[model samples]
Target: MTCPRCDAATIAFSIPAALRAHLPDDRPGAALCTHCLTVTPLDDPPDDTPSFERVSDAFPANDEAAVAFACVLALLDSLVLYRAELDAVATYAETHGADVLRALERLDADDGVDAHFDVARRTRQLEQFI
Candidate 1:
């Protein structure tokens, strides 16, 4: 699903059972934006939505830094879904120079083979944005 705020692809995250009770009855779940880190309520949950994934529940939902970290991880986990945000990330990296790429390198190093491949593929795609 696309993020309502940034038009970037979103990751489907099931709301924790503990938190579900607190949301309006009509809200089925939530989606996290790969780029802007916006958490949007979903009226109809997606079929592939994960059930309380670690990254979704690892940190408090209100923590901005944690959410951004989670979103980055999620983005790398499935770059195909988060592909649209790569341009935004690449743009920021260009503006900031090597530091941003260094941070991404750190993240890529910690991830699995798929993430490495995705990063490599997306790095090539970033050239178009540049």
Candidate 2:
């Protein structure tokens, strides 16, 4: 799978045990973006949806696809901040961080501002990485 925000390659598995209780059990979990630090629900396009098919590979690789994905991530981040869902952002970052996931996980295990601060800092860090 790929991140809905950054088009960065990722994997979507079952939601973590810690987070399951907070999410909808009926829906399967989606991948979290390591770059944009956003979590998105899986959204599969129809087989006949040619407009969504931009590559021959199992995952998208085209430049257009990358840009679109990144834009989506940015929009999603803005929405989350606007809604003041800091915990959601922290969870997403914790689930997907390349090296800091563990630290984020620890911090998010309880109610605090550290995770939120880290999420904001890391998100800005990713803008440079991109």
lDDT of each: 0.45, 0.36
Report the Cα lDDT for residue 48, model 2: 26
lDDT of 2 by residue, 1-130 (tens): 6755557654443333343333433233444444434555544422221221222122123333322332223233344332333344333433443223333333234332222135445444444322
Residue-level lDDT for 98 in candidate 1? 30
Candidate 2 backbone collisions, by pair: 5-69, 5-73
lDDT of 2: 0.36
Q: Count the backbone clashes (under 3 Å) in each candidate.
A: 0, 2
Runs with alpha carbons beyond 4 Å of true place in candidate 1: 23-26, 47-130
**Considering every candidate listed, which one attains the maximal lDDT?**
1
Error of 2 at 125 (Å): 19
lDDT of 1 by residue, 22-128 (tens): 33332556676554445667776665534322323333224333333333333444455555654444343334333334444444444221232355454445444
